[model samples]
Target: MSDSKHSGKHDREMLLEMMHSTTKTSAEDLLISYKGILYPSVLCCLETFQALETFEAREDDILVVTYPKSGTNWLVQILYEMVSIVHNKEPLLDTTMIEFGSPEILARFKDRPSPRIISTHLQFKNIPKSMFEKKVKILLVLRNPKDTAISFYNFHNSLPPLPSYNSWNLFFKDFISGKVCYGPYFEFVAAWDNHFNDKTMMAITFEEMKVDFPTALKKISEFCQLPLNEEQIDLVARCTSFNSMKEQSENTHGKLGDSFFRKGEIGDWKNCFTEDQSKVVDEMFEKYLAGTKLGKMLNYAKYCKW
Candidate 1:
């Protein structure tokens, strides 16, 4: 076998070993490593990032980037609708995420026509360099880390490959310490913050979208140059509401038996986090992001309600 194939085989073996072990402390230990980044599985992110290195980028391509469980699906669908409006065609683009590393999906992506939309959870450093060179428009979504942690905790418990925590306290401890998959949340957000000033990237908060849907949609449309009016923006907001998406998600992915939309609310961490856990997370947030834009926007000190 060629060296690349051999290395891919070895990576899969290592991933299986990690998944079989049950007593690991850090979630990183449960992941396979590639290019110095940890992934929940080797089949998806590791190989996707490897192949993505050479994937061509177009000037009009749109990439929706976000951390997991941070309203990625919601934003992607909205973007699709906006694209449909611009082209005056039915939205035929499939919104299934390509980060899972399916060859069929990659083939479709390569063969699909121009102005394609792709989604990823990769850090800014790990994305394809061609995207930067081509100057594609990137939409990034942010959520409070506390809520992100809580939602991700619940989401991972239902997945078999990831470590399952019996209690929120145990998960909270790991999450705060940057031990969970795609974690070190502060670092992830901070890394992306480097590109906040780049005109190619537009950053939006999930809370902002939730509170003022029409305004947020207009901002997104303006950023992408999709040119939607007030009525269209209002329609997109109503169509993409949590309740509407929840129903659609269940109907489409019910066979997967995973809950994709659970309690889509801000300040949800308040219900799961104890006073001690809240304080611990707040301290860690301040330690890692005391002076960053994300830190200021999160305002963990004022909203953690500890």
Candidate 2:
């Protein structure tokens, strides 16, 4: 066989293996290789990993980084408006998460113009080194662990090939133990938090963004050096509000799934977590974050009660 044909055959075999193995009953069966990294065996495949590694970075690239279910889509839309205003461009740019393993994101990014705004759920360590070396801007958004866990529980239940915990108790246990996809919550937050001092990175909290939309927009604009006037900032805030985004999700992005826009409110965990579950999460938070600067900074204990 020709070399090109042989390569195609090999790629097909790998993809088939990944899909077949990913469908297994246990979570351990779902890992696949990409750029030598072990990614959860879910929506992404080998091609997705290759695209992530091969993706080139522009000097002005803006990355929106977050743990899963932590206000990524909301922030991306807000940043999208800021970038659109700055460039005065038409047919707005795509801001899909790189790690989503979407081929469309790969295609759009490869050909898109400079000053691209991309989002990702990859751990800080997995982000492309070129981004760091070039001092590209990174916006890290975090949420209190309780809300994040509840949001993610609903998210995973909708996605197949990822174990759907029928019981909240099982899901809660898995979440506290960090057995889900994308690894542990504490580690992901800490890895990015360590870069808080980097001139290129800015961290924001979901609760803060919820409480103060205009302030969040102002901070984000300034962090990216986009400098929107008060009027423009107000416009962006109104357009990207949780209600606005949730209503526009389907019309704007096509079918984004029911869970994607779910309860974009702070403290939704109150409805989901029982007294015992809340306590378990509190214990995990204390155990994992104790003595760490991030722990001191967040003081999650203040928000422990459901």
Candidate 3:
């Protein structure tokens, strides 16, 4: 078992190296080389930085993980609704008990209630070891790659201190290279894929979440071990829709961020990618994602595959 685990880790590292070749220069690396060329140093730094040192987890903790621009906010909303439904609690919007700051969230293992739900964009290695070791529940949400990249590009552009968008082409290049934070999506997804199990963890696709909200709610309900009645299941489904979240976001003054619904429509990538551009991306996705188990449950259009 140990030899196989080490072998798996070795193979995973090699795969990340290949993906890193396509990543872009990060904010920190730009100071060293103002030139557009990307260096491997950025990848090295990420692997090192992502290696979490001190770690811990409580048995009852619930974690929702996703690459950036995936359905993180929606997952958070879903879990919130789950708690509210199962426990007959009030709406979660006006309280910090359910939602807290980044620092507060990382320390979730410290002082949280039973059946804790915490959402994070942290890469696999950055996660607390105790959680995986103790078999804590983790729900990974994935979206389609093209849409994920597009959503991330738009999200970064919309940030207060906007940076690059040399063109969709350059962004595409850097994206494949794994230069962007919380990317390349395939690597993040694959590296953590093996840890999944019905007991400790489960991987659910955004397309699944999109196609049938009620079914998605059902899966989450089962994972949470709180059986829901017909009415509660219906409410959970209604609560996670793009329209409903958008309404909440507006009411909250958009404070929830793009995690709510960056853009709900499927195939929005068609608008952003020309025929040639789409062709390039398809090639990139094939090269990067082929032969991974992550591909089986993920079909580019098989709902929103990210």
TM-score of each: 0.84, 0.82, 0.74
Report the candidate with higher lDDT, 1 versus 3.
1
Per-residue lDDT of 263 in model 3: 75
Error of 3 at 233 (Å): 0.8
Task: Give the least accurate 10-residue stretch of model 2, judged by summed lDDT.
Answer: 1-10
Question: Which pairs, if any, clash in model 1?
Answer: none
Alpha-carbon lDDT of model 2: 0.72
- Checking candidate 3 for backbone clashes, the offending pairs are 22-177, 23-177, 23-178, 23-179, 24-179, 143-305, 143-306, 144-304, 144-305, 144-306
Cα-based lDDT at residue 216, candidate 3? 80
Residue pairs with backbone atoms closer than 3 Å in model 2 (clashes): none
lDDT of 1 by residue, 1-306 (tens): 112333433332333333344343445555766655556663355556566778788899899988888888788878878877788877653544555544444544776666687888778787888888999999888888889989889977865557678898888877777666665777788888766755898888888888888888999999988998878887788878888878776444442224467778889888888888877767777777678776676656655655
Tens digits of lDDT, candidate 2, 1-306: 112332433332333333334444665655555544445565566666556665678879989988889898788888788878888965363444576534543655767677778888888777877777778898888888888998899876764456677887888887777677777888788766666655788878887788888898888999999989999998888889988888887655444435578887767888878988888777777667767656664547655464
**lDDT at 48, model 3:** 27
Ordered from best to worst lDDT, the candidate numbers read 1, 2, 3
Q: Output the TM-score of candidate 3.
A: 0.74
Name the 10 consecutive residues with the lowest summed lDDT in model 1. Answer: 1-10
**Candidate 3's error at 209, in angstroms?**
1.3
